[model samples]
Target: MKMLEGKVALVTGGGQGVGQGIALALAAEGAHVAVAGRTLATLEQTCGQITQRGGRALAVTCDVMDAGDIERCVSEVVDTLGGLNILVNNAQIVPLGRILDVTDEEFGKGLDSGPVATLRLMRACYPHLKGDGAVINLASSAAVRWDASGYGHYAATKEAIRALSRGAACEWGPDGIRVNVIAPHALSPGLRGWMEACPEEAAAFVRSIPLGRVGDCEDDIGRTVAFLVSDHARYLTGATIPLDGGQAYWG
Candidate 1:
Protein backbone atom coordinates (compact mmCIF):
# COMPACT_ATOMS: atom_id res chain seq x y z
CA MET A 1 0.00 0.00 0.00
CA LYS A 2 1.08 3.59 -0.54
CA MET A 3 2.47 5.20 2.57
CA LEU A 4 0.07 8.12 2.69
CA GLU A 5 -2.90 6.44 1.06
CA GLY A 6 -6.20 8.07 1.91
CA LYS A 7 -4.48 10.96 3.66
CA VAL A 8 -5.42 14.56 2.98
CA ALA A 9 -2.43 16.88 2.79
CA LEU A 10 -2.14 20.65 2.49
CA VAL A 11 0.97 22.42 1.18
CA THR A 12 1.22 26.19 1.39
CA GLY A 13 3.00 28.03 -1.46
CA GLY A 14 2.39 24.86 -3.39
CA GLY A 15 2.48 26.69 -6.69
CA GLN A 16 6.19 26.49 -7.35
CA GLY A 17 9.65 25.16 -6.58
CA VAL A 18 9.95 23.16 -3.35
CA GLY A 19 6.30 23.63 -2.54
CA GLN A 20 5.21 22.24 -5.91
CA GLY A 21 7.59 19.34 -5.56
CA ILE A 22 6.24 18.56 -2.10
CA ALA A 23 2.64 18.60 -3.29
CA LEU A 24 3.51 16.25 -6.12
CA ALA A 25 5.39 13.91 -3.84
CA LEU A 26 2.53 13.75 -1.38
CA ALA A 27 0.01 13.10 -4.12
CA ALA A 28 2.24 10.37 -5.55
CA GLU A 29 2.12 8.66 -2.18
CA GLY A 30 -1.68 8.52 -2.37
CA ALA A 31 -2.66 11.75 -0.73
CA HIS A 32 -5.44 14.10 -1.69
CA VAL A 33 -3.35 17.26 -1.85
CA ALA A 34 -4.58 20.83 -1.81
CA VAL A 35 -2.03 23.25 -3.29
CA ALA A 36 -2.46 26.74 -1.87
CA GLY A 37 -0.90 29.93 -3.22
CA ARG A 38 -1.73 33.46 -4.33
CA THR A 39 -1.43 32.55 -7.99
CA LEU A 40 -4.29 30.43 -9.25
CA ALA A 41 -2.51 29.60 -12.48
CA THR A 42 0.57 28.27 -10.76
CA LEU A 43 -1.45 26.37 -8.20
CA GLU A 44 -3.50 24.84 -10.97
CA GLN A 45 -0.34 23.81 -12.77
CA THR A 46 0.76 21.86 -9.73
CA CYS A 47 -2.64 20.24 -9.50
CA GLY A 48 -2.50 19.37 -13.18
CA GLN A 49 0.78 17.62 -12.70
CA ILE A 50 -0.68 15.65 -9.82
CA THR A 51 -3.61 14.69 -12.00
CA GLN A 52 -1.30 13.53 -14.77
CA ARG A 53 0.32 11.24 -12.26
CA GLY A 54 -3.05 9.72 -11.44
CA GLY A 55 -3.27 11.54 -8.13
CA ARG A 56 -5.99 13.71 -6.64
CA ALA A 57 -5.38 17.38 -5.96
CA LEU A 58 -6.98 20.83 -5.77
CA ALA A 59 -5.76 24.41 -6.12
CA VAL A 60 -6.53 26.99 -3.45
CA THR A 61 -5.81 30.71 -3.72
CA CYS A 62 -4.44 32.18 -0.52
CA ASP A 63 -2.30 35.04 0.70
CA VAL A 64 -0.57 33.92 3.86
CA MET A 65 -0.19 37.44 5.21
CA ASP A 66 -3.91 37.91 5.47
CA ALA A 67 -5.67 36.29 8.43
CA GLY A 68 -8.88 35.96 6.45
CA ASP A 69 -7.04 34.19 3.66
CA ILE A 70 -5.38 31.83 6.10
CA GLU A 71 -8.70 30.92 7.72
CA ARG A 72 -10.39 30.40 4.38
CA CYS A 73 -7.53 28.21 3.19
CA VAL A 74 -7.83 25.79 6.12
CA SER A 75 -11.59 25.65 5.75
CA GLU A 76 -11.34 24.93 2.05
CA VAL A 77 -8.83 22.16 2.63
CA VAL A 78 -11.09 20.52 5.19
CA ASP A 79 -14.27 20.93 3.19
CA THR A 80 -12.86 19.85 -0.13
CA LEU A 81 -10.33 17.22 0.82
CA GLY A 82 -12.55 15.53 3.44
CA GLY A 83 -10.00 15.91 6.27
CA LEU A 84 -6.59 17.37 6.91
CA ASN A 85 -3.92 14.82 7.82
CA ILE A 86 -0.70 16.56 6.88
CA LEU A 87 0.41 20.17 6.55
CA VAL A 88 3.62 21.41 4.93
CA ASN A 89 4.19 25.13 5.41
CA ASN A 90 6.58 25.96 2.56
CA ALA A 91 5.47 29.50 1.90
CA GLN A 92 7.41 32.55 3.03
CA ILE A 93 8.68 35.92 1.81
CA VAL A 94 12.43 35.50 1.98
CA PRO A 95 13.95 38.85 2.98
CA LEU A 96 17.64 39.00 2.28
CA GLY A 97 20.10 41.69 3.37
CA ARG A 98 22.92 42.38 5.82
CA ILE A 99 21.69 42.91 9.40
CA LEU A 100 22.59 46.60 9.35
CA ASP A 101 20.87 47.14 6.01
CA VAL A 102 17.50 45.66 6.74
CA THR A 103 14.53 47.97 7.25
CA ASP A 104 11.64 47.54 9.64
CA GLU A 105 9.27 46.88 6.75
CA GLU A 106 11.57 44.26 5.30
CA PHE A 107 11.97 42.51 8.64
CA GLY A 108 8.25 42.65 9.21
CA LYS A 109 7.63 40.92 5.88
CA GLY A 110 9.82 38.06 6.99
CA LEU A 111 7.98 37.85 10.31
CA ASP A 112 4.51 37.78 8.80
CA SER A 113 5.45 35.36 6.06
CA GLY A 114 7.37 32.92 8.20
CA PRO A 115 6.67 32.29 11.90
CA VAL A 116 3.51 34.35 12.08
CA ALA A 117 1.90 32.57 9.15
CA THR A 118 3.11 29.23 10.40
CA LEU A 119 1.58 29.82 13.82
CA ARG A 120 -1.72 30.90 12.33
CA LEU A 121 -1.94 27.82 10.15
CA MET A 122 -1.05 25.53 13.03
CA ARG A 123 -3.78 27.06 15.13
CA ALA A 124 -6.29 26.76 12.33
CA CYS A 125 -5.43 23.13 11.73
CA TYR A 126 -5.06 22.15 15.38
CA PRO A 127 -8.62 20.93 15.84
CA HIS A 128 -8.52 18.76 12.74
CA LEU A 129 -5.05 17.46 13.59
CA LYS A 130 -6.04 16.21 17.02
CA GLY A 131 -5.22 12.59 16.19
CA ASP A 132 -2.36 11.45 13.98
CA GLY A 133 -1.45 14.71 12.28
CA ALA A 134 1.90 15.87 10.96
CA VAL A 135 3.19 19.37 10.28
CA ILE A 136 6.42 20.11 8.39
CA ASN A 137 7.58 23.74 8.59
CA LEU A 138 10.41 24.94 6.35
CA ALA A 139 13.52 26.43 7.84
CA SER A 140 16.91 27.29 6.27
CA SER A 141 20.60 26.61 6.72
CA ALA A 142 20.96 30.36 7.17
CA ALA A 143 19.46 29.95 10.64
CA VAL A 144 22.46 28.01 11.92
CA ARG A 145 25.35 29.19 9.80
CA TRP A 146 28.21 31.10 11.44
CA ASP A 147 28.25 33.82 8.76
CA ALA A 148 24.64 34.72 8.09
CA SER A 149 25.62 37.98 6.31
CA GLY A 150 22.83 38.80 3.90
CA TYR A 151 20.66 36.12 5.46
CA GLY A 152 20.11 37.78 8.82
CA HIS A 153 16.42 38.48 8.42
CA TYR A 154 15.77 35.16 6.69
CA ALA A 155 17.65 33.30 9.39
CA ALA A 156 15.78 35.03 12.16
CA THR A 157 12.41 34.04 10.77
CA LYS A 158 13.53 30.49 10.11
CA GLU A 159 14.93 30.15 13.62
CA ALA A 160 11.64 31.40 14.96
CA ILE A 161 9.88 28.67 12.99
CA ARG A 162 12.20 26.09 14.50
CA ALA A 163 11.41 27.29 18.01
CA LEU A 164 7.70 27.32 17.29
CA SER A 165 7.82 23.83 15.87
CA ARG A 166 9.64 22.53 18.90
CA GLY A 167 7.11 24.08 21.27
CA ALA A 168 4.20 22.79 19.24
CA ALA A 169 5.70 19.32 19.15
CA CYS A 170 5.88 19.25 22.91
CA GLU A 171 2.37 20.58 23.38
CA TRP A 172 0.73 18.52 20.65
CA GLY A 173 2.59 15.21 20.90
CA PRO A 174 0.16 13.93 23.50
CA ASP A 175 -2.60 14.51 21.02
CA GLY A 176 -0.90 12.44 18.29
CA ILE A 177 0.33 15.47 16.35
CA ARG A 178 3.96 15.67 15.28
CA VAL A 179 5.60 19.01 14.53
CA ASN A 180 9.00 19.30 12.88
CA VAL A 181 11.14 21.74 10.90
CA ILE A 182 13.24 21.03 7.82
CA ALA A 183 16.21 23.14 6.71
CA PRO A 184 16.37 22.06 3.12
CA HIS A 185 19.18 22.54 0.56
CA ALA A 186 17.15 21.79 -2.50
CA LEU A 187 17.82 23.51 -5.83
CA SER A 188 14.77 25.70 -5.40
CA PRO A 189 13.92 28.75 -7.47
CA GLY A 190 15.60 31.07 -5.01
CA LEU A 191 18.70 28.94 -4.91
CA ARG A 192 18.78 28.79 -8.67
CA GLY A 193 18.53 32.52 -8.93
CA TRP A 194 21.40 32.91 -6.49
CA MET A 195 23.46 30.45 -8.49
CA GLU A 196 22.85 32.39 -11.68
CA ALA A 197 23.74 35.66 -10.03
CA CYS A 198 26.90 34.34 -8.43
CA PRO A 199 28.22 31.36 -10.33
CA GLU A 200 31.55 31.19 -8.52
CA GLU A 201 29.99 31.33 -5.09
CA ALA A 202 27.40 28.77 -6.08
CA ALA A 203 30.07 26.42 -7.36
CA ALA A 204 32.06 26.83 -4.18
CA PHE A 205 29.00 26.17 -2.09
CA VAL A 206 28.26 22.99 -4.05
CA ARG A 207 31.80 21.69 -3.52
CA SER A 208 31.57 22.39 0.20
CA ILE A 209 28.82 19.83 0.48
CA PRO A 210 30.07 16.30 1.19
CA LEU A 211 27.45 15.06 -1.25
CA GLY A 212 28.99 17.21 -4.03
CA ARG A 213 25.55 18.05 -5.38
CA VAL A 214 22.52 20.16 -4.58
CA GLY A 215 19.33 18.29 -3.68
CA ASP A 216 16.34 17.74 -5.92
CA CYS A 217 13.17 19.24 -4.59
CA GLU A 218 10.94 16.18 -5.03
CA ASP A 219 13.35 13.28 -4.77
CA ASP A 220 15.26 14.60 -1.80
CA ILE A 221 13.35 17.08 0.36
CA GLY A 222 9.87 16.05 -0.69
CA ARG A 223 10.41 12.34 -0.17
CA THR A 224 11.85 13.01 3.26
CA VAL A 225 8.73 14.97 4.14
CA ALA A 226 6.57 12.10 2.88
CA PHE A 227 8.35 9.76 5.25
CA LEU A 228 8.40 12.25 8.11
CA VAL A 229 4.63 12.65 8.05
CA SER A 230 3.99 8.95 7.69
CA ASP A 231 3.51 6.42 10.49
CA HIS A 232 7.17 5.58 10.03
CA ALA A 233 8.16 8.85 11.69
CA ARG A 234 5.52 8.75 14.41
CA TYR A 235 8.25 8.44 16.98
CA LEU A 236 9.95 11.63 15.78
CA THR A 237 8.92 15.13 16.85
CA GLY A 238 10.26 18.49 18.00
CA ALA A 239 13.31 18.01 15.78
CA THR A 240 15.06 20.44 13.42
CA ILE A 241 16.36 18.31 10.58
CA PRO A 242 19.15 19.56 8.32
CA LEU A 243 18.55 18.39 4.77
CA ASP A 244 21.64 20.16 3.50
CA GLY A 245 23.67 17.10 2.44
CA GLY A 246 26.05 16.92 5.39
CA GLN A 247 27.13 20.53 5.26
CA ALA A 248 25.83 22.21 8.43
CA TYR A 249 25.28 21.03 12.00
CA TRP A 250 22.35 22.12 14.13
CA GLY A 251 23.88 23.00 17.47
Candidate 2:
Protein backbone atom coordinates (compact mmCIF):
# COMPACT_ATOMS: atom_id res chain seq x y z
CA MET A 1 0.00 0.00 0.00
CA LYS A 2 1.07 3.59 -0.62
CA MET A 3 2.36 5.55 2.38
CA LEU A 4 -0.48 8.05 2.25
CA GLU A 5 -3.23 5.97 0.75
CA GLY A 6 -6.66 7.12 1.90
CA LYS A 7 -5.19 10.38 3.23
CA VAL A 8 -6.56 13.85 2.45
CA ALA A 9 -4.24 16.84 2.03
CA LEU A 10 -4.84 20.56 1.61
CA VAL A 11 -2.03 22.72 0.21
CA THR A 12 -2.35 26.49 0.24
CA GLY A 13 -0.98 28.40 -2.77
CA GLY A 14 -1.00 25.11 -4.63
CA GLY A 15 -1.45 26.97 -7.90
CA GLN A 16 2.26 27.39 -8.51
CA GLY A 17 5.85 26.97 -7.37
CA VAL A 18 6.68 24.79 -4.40
CA GLY A 19 3.06 24.48 -3.32
CA GLN A 20 2.08 22.86 -6.62
CA GLY A 21 5.00 20.48 -6.33
CA ILE A 22 4.02 19.42 -2.81
CA ALA A 23 0.41 18.90 -3.87
CA LEU A 24 1.44 16.68 -6.75
CA ALA A 25 3.79 14.68 -4.54
CA LEU A 26 1.08 14.06 -1.97
CA ALA A 27 -1.36 12.95 -4.66
CA ALA A 28 1.23 10.61 -6.11
CA GLU A 29 1.47 9.05 -2.64
CA GLY A 30 -2.24 8.17 -3.01
CA ALA A 31 -3.61 11.15 -1.15
CA HIS A 32 -6.77 12.99 -2.16
CA VAL A 33 -5.41 16.51 -2.57
CA ALA A 34 -7.10 19.89 -2.50
CA VAL A 35 -5.10 22.64 -4.17
CA ALA A 36 -6.21 25.99 -2.79
CA GLY A 37 -5.32 29.48 -3.97
CA ARG A 38 -6.93 32.75 -4.93
CA THR A 39 -6.95 31.87 -8.60
CA LEU A 40 -9.22 29.02 -9.54
CA ALA A 41 -7.66 28.70 -12.97
CA THR A 42 -4.19 27.88 -11.69
CA LEU A 43 -5.58 25.67 -8.96
CA GLU A 44 -7.53 23.76 -11.59
CA GLN A 45 -4.39 23.41 -13.65
CA THR A 46 -2.70 21.62 -10.76
CA CYS A 47 -5.76 19.49 -10.20
CA GLY A 48 -5.80 18.58 -13.86
CA GLN A 49 -2.22 17.48 -13.69
CA ILE A 50 -2.94 15.24 -10.71
CA THR A 51 -6.02 13.73 -12.35
CA GLN A 52 -4.02 13.13 -15.50
CA ARG A 53 -1.66 11.04 -13.38
CA GLY A 54 -4.54 8.91 -12.11
CA GLY A 55 -4.84 10.73 -8.78
CA ARG A 56 -7.78 12.37 -7.08
CA ALA A 57 -7.69 16.16 -6.69
CA LEU A 58 -9.88 19.16 -5.97
CA ALA A 59 -9.38 22.83 -6.78
CA VAL A 60 -10.36 25.32 -4.11
CA THR A 61 -10.28 29.12 -4.29
CA CYS A 62 -8.76 30.62 -1.18
CA ASP A 63 -7.07 33.82 -0.05
CA VAL A 64 -4.89 33.08 2.95
CA MET A 65 -4.84 36.71 4.01
CA ASP A 66 -8.52 36.47 4.88
CA ALA A 67 -9.46 34.67 8.09
CA GLY A 68 -12.90 33.84 6.75
CA ASP A 69 -11.41 32.36 3.60
CA ILE A 70 -8.99 30.25 5.63
CA GLU A 71 -11.84 28.87 7.71
CA ARG A 72 -13.90 28.15 4.65
CA CYS A 73 -11.06 26.41 2.85
CA VAL A 74 -10.46 24.02 5.75
CA SER A 75 -14.16 23.29 6.09
CA GLU A 76 -14.51 22.75 2.36
CA VAL A 77 -11.63 20.31 2.28
CA VAL A 78 -12.88 18.35 5.27
CA ASP A 79 -16.44 18.24 3.99
CA THR A 80 -15.57 17.41 0.40
CA LEU A 81 -12.59 15.12 0.92
CA GLY A 82 -13.79 13.26 4.06
CA GLY A 83 -10.96 14.47 6.39
CA LEU A 84 -7.68 16.36 6.41
CA ASN A 85 -4.53 14.40 7.11
CA ILE A 86 -2.03 16.95 5.92
CA LEU A 87 -1.89 20.73 5.83
CA VAL A 88 0.74 22.69 3.93
CA ASN A 89 0.90 26.42 4.60
CA ASN A 90 2.82 27.46 1.51
CA ALA A 91 1.22 30.80 0.61
CA GLN A 92 3.02 34.01 1.61
CA ILE A 93 3.65 37.46 0.21
CA VAL A 94 7.24 38.39 0.96
CA PRO A 95 7.83 42.03 1.80
CA LEU A 96 11.34 43.07 0.86
CA GLY A 97 12.88 46.20 2.37
CA ARG A 98 15.31 47.28 5.05
CA ILE A 99 13.91 47.35 8.53
CA LEU A 100 13.80 51.13 8.65
CA ASP A 101 12.41 51.47 5.13
CA VAL A 102 9.68 48.83 5.44
CA THR A 103 6.40 50.66 5.69
CA ASP A 104 3.64 49.69 8.07
CA GLU A 105 1.53 48.38 5.24
CA GLU A 106 4.33 46.18 3.90
CA PHE A 107 5.18 44.81 7.32
CA GLY A 108 1.53 44.21 8.03
CA LYS A 109 1.13 42.28 4.81
CA GLY A 110 4.02 40.04 5.74
CA LEU A 111 2.67 39.39 9.22
CA ASP A 112 -0.87 38.75 8.07
CA SER A 113 0.08 36.30 5.35
CA GLY A 114 3.10 34.63 6.88
CA PRO A 115 2.52 33.82 10.53
CA VAL A 116 -1.08 34.91 10.99
CA ALA A 117 -2.50 32.89 8.15
CA THR A 118 -0.45 29.87 9.09
CA LEU A 119 -1.73 29.96 12.65
CA ARG A 120 -5.30 30.44 11.50
CA LEU A 121 -5.15 27.48 9.18
CA MET A 122 -3.55 25.28 11.82
CA ARG A 123 -6.24 26.18 14.30
CA ALA A 124 -8.93 25.52 11.76
CA CYS A 125 -7.47 22.15 10.86
CA TYR A 126 -6.63 21.13 14.43
CA PRO A 127 -9.79 19.13 14.98
CA HIS A 128 -9.29 16.97 11.94
CA LEU A 129 -5.52 16.56 12.37
CA LYS A 130 -5.64 15.25 15.90
CA GLY A 131 -4.57 11.64 16.42
CA ASP A 132 -2.37 11.67 13.30
CA GLY A 133 -1.61 14.47 10.86
CA ALA A 134 1.25 16.63 9.67
CA VAL A 135 1.57 20.35 9.02
CA ILE A 136 4.40 21.77 6.90
CA ASN A 137 5.05 25.51 7.15
CA LEU A 138 7.44 27.31 4.82
CA ALA A 139 10.43 29.40 5.89
CA SER A 140 13.24 30.87 3.74
CA SER A 141 17.00 30.56 3.56
CA ALA A 142 17.37 34.24 2.73
CA ALA A 143 16.14 35.06 6.19
CA VAL A 144 19.28 33.68 7.83
CA ARG A 145 21.85 35.18 5.49
CA TRP A 146 24.92 36.92 6.89
CA ASP A 147 23.85 40.01 4.96
CA ALA A 148 20.08 40.17 5.27
CA SER A 149 20.13 43.83 4.35
CA GLY A 150 16.72 44.25 2.73
CA TYR A 151 14.82 41.23 4.00
CA GLY A 152 13.95 42.45 7.45
CA HIS A 153 10.22 42.20 7.03
CA TYR A 154 10.35 38.90 5.26
CA ALA A 155 12.75 37.39 7.74
CA ALA A 156 10.76 38.55 10.75
CA THR A 157 7.57 37.05 9.41
CA LYS A 158 9.20 33.76 8.54
CA GLU A 159 10.86 33.54 11.93
CA ALA A 160 7.51 34.03 13.57
CA ILE A 161 6.19 31.16 11.49
CA ARG A 162 9.02 28.96 12.73
CA ALA A 163 8.31 29.88 16.33
CA LEU A 164 4.64 29.12 15.86
CA SER A 165 5.36 25.72 14.36
CA ARG A 166 7.68 24.79 17.22
CA GLY A 167 5.12 25.78 19.80
CA ALA A 168 2.41 23.81 18.10
CA ALA A 169 4.59 20.74 17.72
CA CYS A 170 5.26 20.75 21.43
CA GLU A 171 1.73 21.58 22.54
CA TRP A 172 0.01 19.23 20.08
CA GLY A 173 2.39 16.30 20.47
CA PRO A 174 0.03 14.53 22.82
CA ASP A 175 -2.71 14.94 20.21
CA GLY A 176 -0.54 13.23 17.57
CA ILE A 177 -0.18 16.29 15.33
CA ARG A 178 3.27 16.91 13.97
CA VAL A 179 4.21 20.45 12.94
CA ASN A 180 7.42 21.23 11.08
CA VAL A 181 8.95 23.91 8.85
CA ILE A 182 10.96 23.77 5.62
CA ALA A 183 13.37 26.35 4.25
CA PRO A 184 13.74 25.60 0.55
CA HIS A 185 15.98 27.02 -2.15
CA ALA A 186 14.23 25.93 -5.31
CA LEU A 187 14.05 27.39 -8.81
CA SER A 188 10.88 29.33 -8.16
CA PRO A 189 9.52 31.91 -10.61
CA GLY A 190 11.29 34.73 -8.77
CA LEU A 191 14.60 32.90 -8.74
CA ARG A 192 14.18 31.89 -12.38
CA GLY A 193 13.65 35.49 -13.39
CA TRP A 194 16.76 36.52 -11.46
CA MET A 195 18.76 33.80 -13.14
CA GLU A 196 17.54 34.93 -16.55
CA ALA A 197 18.52 38.51 -15.87
CA CYS A 198 21.87 37.71 -14.27
CA PRO A 199 23.14 34.43 -15.56
CA GLU A 200 26.67 34.96 -14.30
CA GLU A 201 25.47 35.87 -10.83
CA ALA A 202 23.11 32.92 -10.84
CA ALA A 203 25.93 30.59 -11.81
CA ALA A 204 28.13 32.01 -9.07
CA PHE A 205 25.32 31.61 -6.57
CA VAL A 206 24.76 28.00 -7.60
CA ARG A 207 28.48 27.33 -7.27
CA SER A 208 28.42 28.73 -3.76
CA ILE A 209 26.02 25.99 -2.72
CA PRO A 210 27.91 22.97 -1.40
CA LEU A 211 25.78 20.72 -3.57
CA GLY A 212 26.60 22.86 -6.64
CA ARG A 213 22.98 23.24 -7.78
CA VAL A 214 19.64 24.72 -6.99
CA GLY A 215 16.84 22.39 -5.88
CA ASP A 216 14.13 20.88 -8.05
CA CYS A 217 10.64 21.91 -7.09
CA GLU A 218 8.97 18.55 -7.57
CA ASP A 219 11.79 16.08 -7.12
CA ASP A 220 13.75 17.60 -4.25
CA ILE A 221 11.26 19.70 -2.31
CA GLY A 222 8.07 17.79 -3.04
CA ARG A 223 9.52 14.39 -2.31
CA THR A 224 10.94 15.55 1.02
CA VAL A 225 7.66 17.14 1.99
CA ALA A 226 5.88 13.88 1.19
CA PHE A 227 8.20 12.02 3.51
CA LEU A 228 7.81 14.55 6.28
CA VAL A 229 4.04 14.27 6.20
CA SER A 230 4.05 10.50 6.00
CA ASP A 231 4.47 8.00 8.81
CA HIS A 232 8.02 7.43 7.62
CA ALA A 233 8.89 10.60 9.54
CA ARG A 234 6.66 9.67 12.43
CA TYR A 235 9.28 10.54 15.03
CA LEU A 236 10.09 13.98 13.63
CA THR A 237 8.32 17.17 14.70
CA GLY A 238 9.05 20.81 15.59
CA ALA A 239 12.14 20.68 13.38
CA THR A 240 13.21 23.05 10.60
CA ILE A 241 14.57 21.23 7.58
CA PRO A 242 16.63 23.30 5.17
CA LEU A 243 16.24 21.91 1.66
CA ASP A 244 18.82 24.31 0.24
CA GLY A 245 21.53 22.01 -1.07
CA GLY A 246 23.69 22.42 2.06
CA GLN A 247 23.67 26.18 1.80
CA ALA A 248 22.43 28.28 4.74
CA TYR A 249 21.34 25.22 6.66
CA TRP A 250 19.47 25.52 9.95
CA GLY A 251 21.34 23.98 12.84
lDDT (CA) for every model shown? 0.93, 0.93
Model 2 ranges with Cα > 4 A deviation: none
lDDT of each residue in 128-231, candidate 2, tens digit only: 99999999999988778989899878999999999999999999999999999999998878889999999999999999899999998888999999999999
Colliding residue pairs in candidate 1: none
TM-score for all models, in order of appearance:
0.98, 0.98
Global lDDT of model 1? 0.93
Candidate 1 error regions (>4 Å)? none
**CA lDDT, candidate 1, residue 56:** 95
Candidate 1 residue lDDT tens string, 48-145: 99999999999999999999999999999999889999999999998999878989999999999899999999999999998999999999988778
Q: What's model 2's lDDT at 235?
A: 100
